[model samples]
Target: MSKSVLVVLSEYGYWAEELVGPLEALDEAGYRVDFATPTGKRPVPIGVSLDPEYVDPPLGRSVTTAEMADKGRRLDASSRLDDPINLAAWLPDRPYRSEPDFLRRQEEYFRALAAELSKADRYDALLIVGGSGPIVDLANNGRLHELILHFYRTGKPIAAECYGVACLAFARDQENRRSIIDGKHVTGHCIEYDYKDGTGFEGTDFVIGPPPYPLEYILRDATGPDGAYIGNFGRETSVIVDYPFITGRSTPDSRLTGDKLVEVLDKGLRTWGFVPRTGVVAPEPAAAGDR
Candidate 1:
């Protein structure tokens, strides 16, 4: 049977390639994908992401190819994004303890909440698409964290790219207050790739000098002593699959991230990037051209 995946996007703005690359790979593998956003609003790609000649402020070169730009533009113009699942509406609200009938109400609320989270069972995996936008909303979203927790607890594959990896670092259980990725090997945007200036969210006027927080440092601290963070900054690509958690370093690793997720689903591949202590080497995905 074909697997289904839930793809979460940021409402601020997303990189076109970050979404398109994985989507193309998923499409080729025949997996059904459902898109969701923090609000009911349809997500939009950063303008630079859809411009073939647009030069990256940090890299000082045009990163998007003509073909990818065309694909991103087409996807953005489609009506498919019109009816995305509204995370705010679909996810349960957090009830306060000070409210009336706190204990009984909380019990009843949790029971319903569990049922709502179980909707994730329909998806074989959850992918968080990356861009500057995720830095604004997706990184610290409680609703998104609950959703990630649902997938993590069920042993479903969870993939994240670029800044989207921040979501994994923050998804924690209230009981332990530990991040979901507390002990999982993962990769994300490296320090070397960070922008020096002009970091801003779409649909807003404010522009920050750099990302509000350094993702690489956050990942390093979140993983703790047992788990390692692999930057692989200058490498062709970096995609790590440590069981349920799959992480990609940056935009270039997007397609490979999707491929590895498919491997985890189809071939029972358990680990990659870091050396496994079990001495059982994980199989690598088929080679493909760089994105």
Candidate 2:
């Protein structure tokens, strides 16, 4: 039987191509992909063909019209969340959103999701697809931390793209702290792109660009030592591979990111000689430091 791959989404309306691009690749590789969200129902791909501007440039050349047509059909069909496994139950409402507080809730959510993952023995890897909505869900949700922890512990490959990488924020190490992303190489929507076009939709100062709200800066701040030179950051070109965890900058990097994820899963499964349990050591922290 083909290996099972779990794909998680935040909301119904995300960039359609991000999920579709990778799903197609994994499917072609003989992997059975199961979609999930905070709720088990079908998620809405926020950016669809209706917006010509957001159509991925690469899709024009590599993605066929027939494929997109099928995707549109499937997308339309997923509106009701037919069989969702509720993510809300697994995750906690922020204890204090005002204080950047999600500690207690995350612990609760993570444990529940971890339990579910343990029962899904068929899955060999976890793929977190990204879209604009991640800013609203995947980035800081504690339950996602639990999800990441379970997969990471089980020696399964944990892959994400664009904002999906934000899920890494809540991931804890042996010391039970944040996983640092500095010097390890990572990418996502840049501050410039967010501010350039995402402001009105995301709201003023909603993003981390312009003068420091961009994800890069946020990640930089979150990872490096206190007062570390945040200005000396790079790794911004996307395509950061740390093994067991693969991340991309934006939608454009989805194909490569997905392909890499498959490669890692294939290798990880083959190397273990058996499925790895939860809590397997992932790639060494991007940098060894307090998170």
Q: Across residues 1-291, which tens digit of lDDT does each residue of candidate 1 receive? A: 899999999989999889998898889989999999998789999988889888877667887899989999999999877878999888776678899888888788778779889887999999999999999999999899999999998889999999999999999998898988877788999988898998878889878998989999999999887787888765668888888999998777887888888888888998877676432223433374356
TM-score of 1: 0.93
**lDDT (Cα) of model 2:** 0.58
Clashes of each: 0, 22
Q: In angstroms, how far off is 274's CA in candidate 2?
A: 29
Model 1 alpha-carbon miss at residue 285, Å: 8.6
Give the runs in model 1 whose Cα sits over 4 Å from its true position.
96-105, 277-289
Looking at model 2, residue 33 earns an lDDT score of 78
The TM-score values for the models, in the order shown, are 0.93, 0.67
The count of backbone overlaps in candidate 2 is 22
TM-score of candidate 2 relative to the true fold: 0.67
